[model samples]
Target chain A: MRICIMGGCGHFHTALKPDIELAGVCLTGEETPGFSFLINRFGKVPVFPSYEEMLKECMPDLVVIDGLFGHHADMAVCALERGIHVYCEKPMAINEEQYKRLKNAYKASNAQIAAMLTSRYEPCFYTLYKRVRERTIGNIKLINAQKSYIFGERPQFYAHPEQYGNTFMWVGIHSVDLILWLTNSSIVDSHYFPSGKNSFGFEGLDESAVAILKLQNGVLATVTVDFLRDEDADTHGDDRIRVVGDKGILEVKDERLYLFKDGEEQELELSDAPDIFLDFIENLDDKGKRLADDEAAFLSTEAVVNITGV
Target chain B: MRICIMGGCGHFHTALKPDIELAGVCLTGEETPGFSFLINRFGKVPVFPSYEEMLKECMPDLVVIDGLFGHHADMAVCALERGIHVYCEKPMAINEEQYKRLKNAYKASNAQIAAMLTSRYEPCFYTLYKRVRERTIGNIKLINAQKSYIFGERPQFYAHPEQYGNTFMWVGIHSVDLILWLTNSSIVDSHYFPSGKNSFGFEGLDESAVAILKLQNGVLATVTVDFLRDEDADTHGDDRIRVVGDKGILEVKDERLYLFKDGEEQELELSDAPDIFLDFIENLDDKGKRLADDEAAFLSTEAVVNITGV
Candidate 1:
């Protein structure tokens, strides 16, 4: 299982390097600096200057894309067209057109494509998902998903909406993915409210965004994302989801899953979460079920892009 | 002030009888049963057969309307027309036409009116409101207000949507009131989703509803109300409100207020909440500020009714 890395600036892809190594997947080549140092500081593997060169020389079985948001679709499409399994960072693409191109390329190949939607792999959320699927909360009627992050230092690309994507597409898509996944529903309608007043002078950037989504299953959901968390707060981000169902309510907040059912509140004991990178690699052999495959990525990315108008 | 009571079925007015009495207001006459029992449980006050009869004979300075939802507007209008201050149960009217008539009648009189929007008087909510007013959370960007209640026994009137208001207008209005009051904004645009699956066979009654409101202040808010709580639950209702601002987040859950600001979480010490009934009496004498006054009640009811299309 030879894997080549391209554009390793994204934190998600960078974080997956160690896990991929631990899974015994071979890192054939790299196209980004410092990534090679991370794989092997002794320089046993050659680091290529570009993805095309790496594909031509290394002929890796898999390609991991961790580039600017705007470039992900092109990179994924290229890899898929070459019959290489691709693990792309979320969102899978910047817009529906790019997503369509990638989807077309994937249809032409036998490789498996996955996106880094890690929320489903978190222990608390995984527990909540299982409870929901088991009908612990009965039929879900409404969902309120929130994502709040500290406005930390950003790369120059973030200042350009064309490269970084809008706040909802970049950050809110996680909640969108969760809504679709947990509810087993598709978006029927959506509206977006974006604000830039508190962007701290980041031009063309929305500091906060609220997306109201109506799902086909007759469920109403709202996803609110903001980069306004205090940098020194107890957590880097405040991620929470509340699911209201006919029988009861379920909420995941501060890394704990709480279920209110039958007039009693109880916290579920969550098992250790499966590693997304490892699971993606393992599913390559069996073609078995994966949490966030290409289809999930496409749906979430499309819905978010449509809502945010990005 | 001499006060008369009409249709004492609503628990709000029943609960306030003692407070009105302590405020030295005389109960000149009554129009409904059980109300006289609540006020004296004896034959201390004369019980009239109807509101008009009580009004004609007593000529009371104030009228407390604890009638069915459909009758609130007419009762308020009747008292207001006679220059009698009125305290009516919530959902001041079941529909827009009734609300409009009440508003017009209120405009044509000097009498002050109030509604049973008791959420603003809860100790925890009072603290949360004060903090928001103090800008403790910065400018409000998004609000998620939730009301979940146990599916308790209901009267026959609840089976008719024409009599009792829809779920959003009746239960979700408290959240709407809070949104308008806390954000200091009026709703500019709104949408509602109503479902009746869990209404316990109550025809034409919605057991759950979700309302998405866009406020004039550019704030986005969602209010979800459901009567699906377990009857034996620790609390009869699960009421929660989450306010997201640029600098921090404020949440009131389980009768406690939590603030997340500057990267830290803390529980706020709340002051004792003033009694709504007593405050209304005091404000009548002083012409001072009162929470959930006629204007607040009118705005909230109108917004909910408009959103629910009831």
Candidate 2:
């Protein structure tokens, strides 16, 4: 399958490049120096100066979007309207209106849509999902999802909250997707707390945020996201989820899954899961079960946008 | 000082009995079998039939209240009005009216008052507090406090939400006090998600709760409290507090303190801190600095009550 890459600037496409071959490329006109060289090291794909040129020239089966968050809706809508499947990076869009546009476009097309929600593909999370389904823990009553990322050097877009979306919508949507996917529930109510007090002098950027949500299954969940992790830590991100159920508690911390049941702690062996990019590619033909489909993507983005008011 | 133990039914005072001698006892008429024999093993203190009898007979200088949650305010007010110091168990009052009455009573008297907020006395938390004061994690931006208790056999009071406060106010107040005490900030806005879904067949008892709070210093904090822990776990309670600041993050878990700073993980050595009960006894005469004073107690309780809308 021919895959056209749009906005070859962010690392999302570069990370997925190993799993899928790129047929064409389009710049978002905001690429940094040497961005094309960084993305197309093999120099095998034709680099188009505009997305329209690339779409018409490549006529690719799938379009992977890694553009500016504010421009995602336009890119996604353009691709979906052409009946091309889309694999867009997270924050799917900057606001609800843009998300709605993407959703409407997907409804009108025969093509499938998915977002790069990597948490859904994590081995630890996959293990937790399996155990919860097996009732290792009884009915979940509470969930605490935490995501912390090191604020490494960033591009100019991060300085503008309006363009990049707030911290919760930008980074916290991963946890939102994980919670919904693992619990098989939808959000009933949510409250957000966003702060730019410790943005390290970055104006208009929220450095930290917390979202408390009530799920339809009567489970209370809180998602906390921040960019305050130490850059030299053992991991780039401290991702953890604690699920409290009637019978036991399950936790995924430090890339390991643990089940505290019957007053004893046991580490559950994590099983390997297919890569998200591979799953997306396989779904193109067989249309088998995908971790995050168009509906899941839309619902996660919508819940985050509504909670963070982004 | 002559300390009077009221409602000698629970183990809160019995656990502290080794730290101080009891002069008088007053039961709330809900004592379990051989309660007096268990508390007053030496049979040295006078077992009064009523609180009035104990107060008039013993004329104690300090009153330690472990009564029902519903009667805490009246007992506290009675002690405060007589110029007697009071050390009461947590959820100082079940609701705002009772808390306000206690606040007014404390203001109207010179007597000191403190609550058994044991989280403040934890050694690991003390270490985290000292490091945070030294700017180890820089300015605090976010805090995620968690408390999980094993719901073992309970008294009948827990079955009635009116007699005993709901889960958030009953248990989560410890995290609230810790947040305020460590950060030295007051709550600005708060929201609570309380669920009785997993009460394990107990009616009116909230098995889990989450509170999202915005502090006056622009810090976003969330506190999750639940009674769904495995009873046979290594610890009776799983208490943790993760503080994310501009520079790094500090966490207290498993009775140990960990600082993730400068891209490296370090286990902090916990320093011994004065016990809550001992501190209260020492502060009685000196009127010295106390970790949880009358105002701190009132503020913590007020913040919790307002947030939980109890």
Candidate 3:
């Protein structure tokens, strides 16, 4: 089963590299960051100049897309058209039309698909996920989460939501995926409130926003997503989430799991988390049951691109 | 100067006990829990059998309304009509009509008033408040705060929204006060999303809810308020807040102030927090300058009472 890579946009495809080398890999038409890493190590831009050419020759079992944000859906749909599995960076689609097309192709083909929602596989989140499933905190009543990133040097594509999409879809989707994965709840209703003031001079960039989600099982959650972190911030991203339950509370921050139980703040040992990319490879045939809902990634992206801001 | 006590529903009025004993307190019409405390101590259900009688005789310099949650407004209004100061337990008014009357009376009088918004005076929050004023976390971007309470035995009034009010206003009011007080920003637009489901057993009880506040200075905040805490939980209430700004981040919880700056989490030495009741007593002449916005409290309660639920 051949695995193929496409596009040079982001480093998400790097997750597939070690596995790609170990199992033998094929390069599709685009010159991606992964391509250079492979070329500098193995010598040569390693041929196949296009997606159609790669598909005709390689007939790869999977396609990993790390392309322009807007191009992910069409690329995934192209793979799905031939029943190839896709391990694409979020989101698989940027618009309702694009999502619908990808959904159609995915349903019609016998293919496995995944959005790169890797946060849930982090050791801290994984430990929390196990504890949540174990009812460590009891019935979840509310959740408050944050994902903040610095506005350090963006690729020119970011200036256009049509190409890069807004930070709500680009960055916020990770939390959207993890919260759903951990809570095992569906979003009955969600609203994205964008702060339109601070865009750092990019007229189309949505620098800050919040997502309010009402889960079907009576859980209320608010996700604060922003690219407003100051350059002086020590880290490029700040991720934190606190889950409050009827029994107690649990928090995941700075690679640590904190349990606030019986008024005690205990930092619990983290659970070992599986590499998402390796897990995807190992469970290729299990289909949708294995991955954080790729469709959620698509749906959220579609919802935010045409955001009804408040 | 005299401090007269009114009815007692909750134990918050206990904060005034020492001062009341030292400063010579008076008791007005109606039997309150405080009346029992004073009577049990002084060997009598002391004096006045009516508010008017107490006003005429005691001419109390201030009134502390710790009556039925619904009667707070009328109680405050009565004192305001006579230019007497009031330190009322929250929702100075429950409905718009009540708030309008309270506002009218307040505007026409020289009375100093404060809501029992005591959480902002906690050492952790007070410390964060100082740093915010000092511009420690420069240019606020967003805020996430929580106030969770256990559904311990509630008063008979809990079954009546008309009397007890929803938890959104009753409990969430604390966070509204603190978030606004710390940010030093006015609420530009606000919304209350009540998860009108988990009401334990009382149909009228708002067991869980979230308040989304858009501040005037581009601060986005969400307040999660609930009465879904399990009885076995350690504390009666779990209060927490995280303020993120362009410069750094700060959190207040568990009686400690945590600052996340330059990727380092530091538990900072807390600043001295003035006793809220003591501060109010000392600064009665300062009017609205000292207390967390009493109007924000009233406005929030008023807005939520007539909530347009989603």
Most accurate candidate by TM-score: 2
Per-residue CA lDDT of model 1 for B1-310, tens digit only, reads 6677776546444334543431212322323344444566423676676778788788887787767778889889998999988887788998889999999999999999888888999999988999998889888888888898886866667777777778887788889999999988888877666764436888888777776787888788777788877777998788999898877889999999999877678999988988887778778855448876778878887887888786
iRMS values in order, in angstroms? 2.3, 1.1, 2.9
lDDT, model 1, position A34: 54
Q: Which one is best on DockQ?
A: 2
Worst 10 residues of 2 chain B by lDDT: B8-17
- Give the per-residue lDDT digits (tens) of candidate 1, residues A1-310: 6677767555434334533332212222322345555656423556566677677777777887877778888888888878888888888888778877888888889988888888989999988888899898889888888898887766666777878788888899889999999988898877777765436677778777776777888787777788877778877788999898878889888889998877678888996778787778877766557777668867887887787775
TM accuracy, model 3: 0.88
Number of the top lDDT candidate: 2
Instruction: Compose the digit string of candidate 2's lDDT tens values, residues B1-310.
Output: 6788888434454334564567888878765456666666646777888787788777788898878777888888999988888888777888888988888999899889888877777899877888999998888889999999888776677777877778898889889998998789999899988986536677788888998999898888999998888888777788999998877789999999998877778899999977787777777766556767777778877888899886
Model 3 spans with C-alpha error above 4 angstroms: A19-35, A42-57, A229-236, A262-265, A288-310, B11-35, B38-57, B230-234, B293-310
Scored against the true structure, residue A254 in model 2 reaches a CA lDDT of 95
Better structure of 2 and 3 per DockQ: 2
